[model samples]
Target: MWTTLFLSYSPIPEYEYVENSIPTFVAIGGFPFIAFHYPSPPMGSDVVSQSMWPLFYLNEFFWLIIGTILTKLLPQKIKNYSQIRLFCIVMTLIISLSGLGYLVLRFD
Candidate 1:
């Protein structure tokens, strides 16, 4: 899930430049799933600095692996994943509703 460099920055923030993606949702696991396109890529020399990124799909992939292992290890505690799945579905619905509103209001 990606967009065509659709967002602007806070140095001159505006309403129309907002962009989002699902990898962000899986990565961050919260409200306001923003798509962050840096003006330039982080160099290898800046190791610590790179970790501060708002978006990290690689992190999300590893997290998913860990989460799956954990879920398997704690199936009974999580109610066989049903409860968590329900919660995620509900949150997705809420976010989608808000995003629809955002697009409607953002565009003419």
Candidate 2:
């Protein structure tokens, strides 16, 4: 995830030039998820800066690890494995719903 994020920020002049214009959501999909639901449309920089960004990155890192381990380390017979899979599915649904809610609720 970090690699992808960093690569996304790679010092390509075109990327930088493109990043300079448009709403934050136009630069990346994530903000649109929030701004779409937010009561007020998002303004200002869309770039994820600040110490919290590392935390967000780390959170995604851990989720990736968890997903990998769940798929690779678990045996098929474990009853809880099904539950875990369900939980993951539910998590994806909930996240998408939230994004959709953001999009639907925002005035824009």
Candidate 3:
């Protein structure tokens, strides 16, 4: 989605200082599952912005609502399909593991 794309490419002012210094993975989905380094504020800078923190939780709630509505709207037949379930499980694992791998390699 647009949010993931924007977060990946756009320069968020709060993150500007540590952008290139850290590795970030914005998972592919309607809601971003972010895995990234949390950099401390630069030395001697006392202003630690908490603005982005609330947005992360807000985004999760928004997507939860959307997902609930979608599940209700979707037909049971489609939801019950083995292929769909398998695909979802596989994709989730792949994305989650990829993010984990990136973090591990980054720290190592």
Per-residue accuracy of model 3 over 1-108 as CA lDDT, tens digit each = 234423553233544446566424222222354423333323212322354445546656776688799999977765458888899899878876775454334334
CA lDDT for candidate 2:
0.44
Clashes of each: 1, 2, 0
Top candidate, metric lDDT: 3
The segments of candidate 2 whose C-alpha lies over 4 angstroms from its true place after superposition are 1-79
Worst 10 residues of 3 by lDDT: 40-49
* Alpha-carbon RMSD, candidate 3: 8.5
Error of 3 at 57 (Å): 3.5
Q: Write the per-residue lDDT of candidate 2 for residues 1-108, one digit (tens) a residue.
A: 333332232222345445446433333322111111112145533333453345445646675887798879766676677788899799888876774454343325
Clash pairs, candidate 2, are 36-102, 37-102
Score candidate 3 by lDDT: 0.48
The alpha-carbon lDDT assigned to residue 60 of candidate 3 equals 60
Best model per TM-score: 3
TM-score for all models, in order of appearance: 0.31, 0.30, 0.41
- Candidate 3, which segments miss by more than 4 Å at Cα? 1-8, 12-54, 99-108
In model 1, where is the ten-residue run with the lowest total lDDT? 22-31
- With a 3 Å backbone cut-off (N, CA, C), the pairs that clash in candidate 3 are none
lDDT of each: 0.40, 0.44, 0.48
Q: Which residue ranges in model 1 land beyond 4 Å of their true spot?
A: 1-77
